[model samples]
Structures are given as C-alpha cells and as structure tokens.
Target: MNRLAILSVSDKTGLIDLARVLVESYQFQLISSGGTAKALKEANLPVTKVSDYTGAPEILGGRVKTLHPKIHGGILSRPDLESDRADLTANDIQPVTLVVVNLYPFEQTIAKAGVSLEQAIEQIDVGGPTMIRAAAKNHQYVSVLSNPAQYNAYLEELKAHNGETRIEFRRSLALAAFSHTQAYDRAIADYLTKEILNEAQAKIDLMEVSSTGATSSQPSLSSSYTLLCHSPKPLRYGENPHQPATWYQLGAAPKGWSAAQQLQGKELSYNNLLDLEAARSIVAEFWNDAPCAVIVKHNNPCGVAIAPTIAEAYQKAFAADSTSAFGGIVALNRPIDEETAKALTSTFLECVVAPACVASVATILAAKPNLRVLVLPEMQQGTSETVKLIAGGMLVQKSDDLPATPETWQVVTQKQPSPEQMQELIFAWKICRHVKSNAIAITGDRVTLGIGAGQMNRVGSAKIALEQAGDRTKGAVLASDGFFPFDDSVRTAAAAGITAIVQPGGSMRDGDSIKAADELGLVMVLTHVRHFLH
Candidate 1:
C-alpha cells in the first residue's frame, strides 16, 4: 500500500516542489484542502481533495472541510495497537504518515493599519490548529511540518532513513508544531483583548461627553499579557562569564537584532548587545542630519558627534572621551569607507555597526579579528513599547520617542540664543534624553564635550559635566533631563562659562532659575517636555 501524506498550507513557498518530490520519489498519496488542493492540481500533480476523500461536501464556506472523523482518526491511529488498527479498519481509515501544514497569517493581518476586529477574527485558524495539535500528540506514528523552512529538513531526514523518518526527527517536528499553534493562539488572544479595551474606552468617552475635559496622553494598560519567543541560541555567558545565558527570538521570522548580519569577529555577549543598542539609539537621532557616530560603554553613551564626513564623525566622537571609548560599542549612520575603517581598526573596540560596508573596507576591518562588525540597514526602527520584569509581575510603557520641537520652546531669559546656538541646544537635548537621570550633557560644535549620567542629584551631575568639559564649557551648551529645583545649578553652569542652557522647566521654583539665568547673561530655554530615563 502507498504511504499517505496530507498537505495543507497558507504559505505557498516551496510547496509545489515538496509535493512533487513526495509523489515522485517517495510514492506517497497527497490529500490537501482548499487552496493547497487547487495549487497541486494546477501543477498537473496527483492530489485528492479533503472533501472528496471524506465523501462530504464542504459546508459553511469550506470551514468544515477538515474537522471530520476520517481526518482525525487517520492522524491519530497507531498501527502497533490492536484496538486502534481494528478501529481504523472498521472505519476504512488510512493512517496518515506525513502532515505538512501551516496556519493563516493572523499576526500579519492585524499588523496592518485600520484592521477591524471582525477582519482579524476571520483570519484566526480553527481547523489548522486542531489538526496540528492532534498530529503533534501522535508523533510516534506521524510526522508534522508547520513551517516552510522545515520542508528541506524533512526531505533530508526521509532520504537519510530510506524513505522513513527517524523517531527523533519526528519528535523535534512535533515540538515545533505545538509551538506554532501556541504562538497563533497567543496572537489571537492579544488582538481580541486590545480591541475589547478600545471598544470599552469608546463607550466611556461617549458617556462623559462634557463632564471630563480631556483624556490622558499616556496609553492605557492591558489586563492580559502574552509573549511568544522561540529559537533559543545559547551564548557563552551573559554579562559575566559565570552567568549562563540564552537568546530567544520573538517570532518565527528573524527581526531586529536577529536580522542583523554579523560580518566578522566573536559571538556577541549580553553586555555587547546592550551597549550596541545604546549606541544605535543615539546614532539614530542624527540619521538624516549628517554623518554621525556614537560610542557607548556600560549601556550609556560616552561620546556622540556628527560631521560632514563619516571619517570625521568617528574621529570627533572618539576624541570626545578617548578614555571611555576604549573597548566600547560604536555605531555609525553611514556606510563604512576606507578612512573610517582605518580609524575604527586603530582602536580596541568591542563592536562596530553601520548601515553598509563594502568588500574593500571589510577586508581592512578583518585586521581586527575579534572585533564584531554588524550591518543593519534599519537602524532607526525602535520598539513601540518597553517591558521590564518585576516582582511577581511586569511593567509596560510606551517608549519615550517624542520628537524635539525647538520652535515651540519658550525663551525665558533676557539673553536670546542665535540660530547656531539654538541648533546646538537641540542636539544636546536629543542626546540627554537617552542618558540615565539625573542626566547632564555638555556639547559644543556638534560634538559632546562632557557627559554626567546617573548621579544622585542634579547639582552633582552638573558639576561633573562642567569639570569634565573644563575650557570646552566656555563656549558649549548644557542640557538637563529635568527641571532644576533651585538656581544653584544655574549659577554653577554660568560660573563654568556655559553660553546657553536647555531643560524641561516645570519645577515649582522655575522663577528662581529663570532670574538667575537672566542675571548671569545666559540663554535659557524651556522645552515643556521631560525625558527622565531611569
């Protein structure tokens, strides 16, 4: 008797090729449903439709095609058990040897803009998950493939074992099948929860049409939380060599850091990736303005600069804090050139990331064998929300990515800033947002002169920044993540010869700082927005 194989899939990638090989090489009968059946027949391959094989017409617009007893019995039957064999024979059911199936694109559908709840509900697969779970539970006598990427591996296994899959291979595929269904169900649950919350909020808004004035700018919290991560790649260690670590990607398809191509050097450690992300975020701030470079150490940016050329940008950023730049992660907004590659290789850096790198420059970078080089084209794509695990729960909030609008700023001092000084202030303000509070950053001539981050108090942070800048503070600008509580910091900045100051002014004693700035003949601007990164 010929072996039986059921092929049902939403993604058609490598479908015809796999089906043809199964029919010609393995002598397996094909049973498919809906689009899969039509595709196989169109290619002039032999296939039996599920409706025809079960001797039942598809009802409810083809949704009831694969939920029949024959389909489930064939997938769950065990040839070794006498009772199962008798039941299969009594019902004239053929035992299914292989199940090639994938679910509908539910996540992709909901990712689109303006998708309705009904539309997303329609995309959720019912019979697909049912059949997948059944096959996975009976992996001893069945082999299930849930993704297109598994087709080649399945074929290789069959070829190696003389047209029969090994028990271990089938077990692995079964595990993947269950994981696939779990992720699908989680996506559906998350979508429904969000839509239901929005519907309830809309009703509340209608009830209080005139009583409540305005809604809060903050996004509402969700009651339910779900995360689907897979493909755990083990690292040598975490932040330290003693801590064990593993990297789990978010989805079946690789994205974000997983999508980045590492051109050379050692595997990335946990700390290396953290520092690289900090550098990436800071360099992304100046992506379209000019060639920019940022160096990060211990999850904080130590140097950031923008120049007319990529080589000059790296040089300026490195010169900003040479001592801290050693063994730091570097990010560049432009492609790596020969000049930049030479400058990058001159230092003992942990990693260097850019949008692109040519073959010649890559060869030059090869001189540093242990330095990691990554090319990620989408450097500006950031997460929509950030999550942190806490005691017995987690915290979730929207990312602080609000744009810096200098035109709406209030000049609260007697001295006004020039166009050039205003641009410098905006640059400093952008970098300050990424630093840990209490944060202070001093910049001059489009380069960071000194940075004071994660201090106990604002005055202490200001003193550290000014002392580090030294003579550079004479013509530089200062940016604070929060409003000054007193005029002492303002006086301290003026004493350091700070030409202008930018801060989020909402403190109770804002007048004292404004008066101090006016008396000291310094330009002070209030952004009306606070960016306190903890």
Candidate 2:
C-alpha cells in the first residue's frame, strides 16, 4: 500500500521540491492544511486537504482543522501491531507514515517592531505542534521533519533506502521536531507571561515554568531569576590544580563572547573569563576619546591608567603594580598599535583584549604563541541583575548604575574643592565606585596612580592606596568609595598631600573630618550616596 505523507509548514522554503519527489517517486499521498494546501494546489500537485480526510470542516477561524480523529488516528497509529491496524481500519484512518511540519512565525512575529500580544498569541501554532508531537510519538514507523535544514539529507536517504528512511534518522528527526516545538512554546509562553502579564517579573520565570512543565524536573526558587547557562566550549582547566571549571554564557540569547569569532588562542578558562570581564568593564569606561590601560587580576583591577598615548597609559598602569601585573590580563581602550604591542610584548602577560589589533601588532604578539589574544568588537553591556551565591541561597540586587553628576555632588568642607580638583574628584569618584569596597583610588592628570580595594577598614584602605601612590600622592586627588568613619582618614590623606578628597559624608564625625580638611587646606566634596562595590 502507498504510504501517507503530511506536509504543513509556515516556511515554504523547499516545499514544492519535496512534494514533487514524495508524490512522483515515493507514491505518498500529501495531506496539507490552509497555506500548505493552497501552495500545493497552486503548483498543480495532487494534495488532499486535512479537513477532507478528517470528514470535518475547518472551524473556529481554522483552529479546529487538524484536531479531528482521522488525522490524529493516522498520525498516532502503530503500524507494527495487528490491533493497531484493525483500529485504523475500523476508524477508516490511513496510517500517516511521514509528517513534515514547521510551526507559524512566532519568532518572526516577536522580532517585528511593534507586534502586539494579541498578534503574537495568534501566531502560536496549536495544530502544527499537535501534528508534530503525534508523528514523533510514532517515530518507530513515522518520519517527522520540522526544519528545512534536514530536507536534502532526508530526501537523499529516502532515495538510497528505497523510500524507507532509517529508524535512527527518523528518531533523530523526531527528537529535533520535539525540541523545536518545546523551544517555540517556551518563547510564546515566556513572552506572554513576562512581557504582557507581568513586566517586572524576572526572566527566570519562563525557565522555572518550563522546568516544572517540561521533561526537566529540576526545582527552582520562586523568587530567584533563572540563569540560562551555556558552555560554548570546554576550557583548558580551572583557576588552580585539582579544581575543574568551565565558562558559562549568561543570557538566553547571547550576542557577544559566546558568539565572538575566536581568531586565535587556546581555550579560555574560568579565571580567564573573570579577568576578561574586568578588563572589558574598565576599558569600556574609558573607550570614548581616551587612551586607557587596565590590568586585571582575579576579576579585580590591579592597575588602571588613562593617558594621551596607549604606550604611556600601559607604562603608568604597569608601574602601579608590576608584581601583580606579571601574569595578569591587560585590556586597552584604544587599538593596539605597533608601539603599544612592542611595549606589551616586553612583559610576560597571560592575555590581551582590545577592539582591534593592528596587523603588525598581531605579528609581534605572535612571538608568544601561548599568549591569548582576544579582539572584542564591543564592550560588554551592563546587566540588570547582579547575583552572588550565599551559603544555601543566592543574593540578588539591581545592578548599581548610579549616575555621578556634578549636580549630585555636595561640598561638605569649609574649603570647597578647586575647579581642577573637582574634575579629578569626579574622575576618581567614577573609578573608585567600580572598585571593591572598602575602596580608595588616587588619581592625577586624568590617570589612576594607586588603588586599594576590599580592605577591612576605610582608613586602612586609604593608607594602602596613599602608600602605593607614594610620591605621586603629593599632587594627586583621593576618592574614598564610602564615608570616613573617623577624622583620622582625613588626617592621613592630608599628611600625604592628597590635595582634595571626595566621599559620601554620612559619618557622624563628618564635622571633625571637615575640620581636619580645613586645617590641611584640602579641598573636600561629599556625594550623599556611598558606592561600595563589594
């Protein structure tokens, strides 16, 4: 008996060709619905409308077309069992040996500029998924094809195997079809639930819903957002020996890093990704009209400097902590020129990331074959959620994107900051806010001289920052990431000839600190909000 094939598709890329082969060579009767039937009819192919075979007219604006018994019975029937054949005969249902279907343009509909929820809802294919699932359930006999990418290979296999596609191939295609439907349903359900129903709901809600409803039975916290993790590739190893790690991309739809063209280098490790993230963030802060150098060690900036020339910036940043930067990751805001590359090659560094690496510069770096070179086209965009794993759960917060403007700055001292001091104060404030707290950064000539981060006390951080600045502290401006709990921090900075100070003045001893600043003839400004990056 001739096999029955059903073809229903929203994307008719290679539909006509496939239909021609199925009809002429395989002698498979084509059953189609709506647009697919119309397309086949237009091409003058012998096609049976699904409603005709099902003995039911398309109803409810075509929604009730394929949900009838005849279509589903043929799709769900098991050809191996005699009882299944008897039931098919009793129901007057011809076994649907093959099903080729692709759903409506839900992805395309969502991608449209001003698509509404109603429009998106309408595009969700009920019949298409139902038919695909029915076919997949009988994968032992029925071959299901949902993607056009599988068309040519499937046709070749059918031609080679005397119109009988292999069970293995059919099973794989069935799996793909199910996955396609699952991802499709997920996109629609997620869009409606998150965007239309609750705009403020976390992105993880979709994943949680999918996990609960789908095959994956993983439990998820109601309050927590779901992190869509993808390991693009395996890494060399982790941070240290005896620890295994892999880099995971965060977003459900990744545009960069995970998709970036890795022109050269070995596999990236967990620490590599952490250092790269730090380098990318720091370089992004100074990308526009400024040459900046950022040396990152363990997801924290060891040194960062801005200058007229990339070489000078690298030199100043490296000089800040040569020991820490020995095997660190270096990022440049500007393009890597020959001079910059030469300076970079002089030192032994683990990785270098920039927007563009010059041909000559790339050739120079090629001397050190193991040095990982990455050309990031754009800086990493800031995320909306910040996640930190606690003992048993996770702590979540809205990312700190607090704007630092001159209007927001408050001058709390008897001696206000000079105009030059105000410029450096704002610059230092911006840099210090991004560093780990308790944080202190000393800046001069639009470049960071020293930074002290993640310390116990604010004064201890200030002293460490000043000590690193050394002679550079004389004319440098200092910024404390948070308030000075005591007047001693003010006295310490004053003795270092710090010139000016910027901090969040919430301390009860603010008057004493102001008095100390006045005695040293230091310029002091207070920003009401404290930025502690830890």
Candidate 1 segments whose C-alpha is farther than 4 A from its true place: 1-5, 11-30, 34-48, 58-64, 76-91, 94-98, 105-123, 137-143, 148-175, 188-222
Model 1: per-residue lDDT, tens digit, 1-534?
889999989999999999999999999999999999999999999999998899988898767879988899999999999999999999989999989989989987887889888888788888888889999999999999999999999999989989998889989999999988988888787777677777777876776686766553325555577677877889989988999998888765667788899999999988888888888888888888899999999888888999999999999999999999999999999999999999999989999999999778878999999999999999988777788899999988888889899989999999999999999999999999999999999999999999999999999999988888889999899999999999999999999889899999999999999999999999999999999988
Query: What TM-score, over all chains together, does every model reach?
Result: 0.83, 0.74
Query: After superposing candidate 2, which stretches have Cα over 4 Å from the reference?
Result: 1-71, 74-87, 94-125, 128-186, 189-224, 228-231, 240-253, 389-395
Best by lDDT: 1
Tens-digit lDDT string for candidate 2 (445-510): 877778888999887888788888888888789999888888898888878878899998898888
Q: How many backbone clashes does candidate 2 have?
A: 1
- Which window of 10 residues has the lowest lDDT sum in candidate 2? 215-224
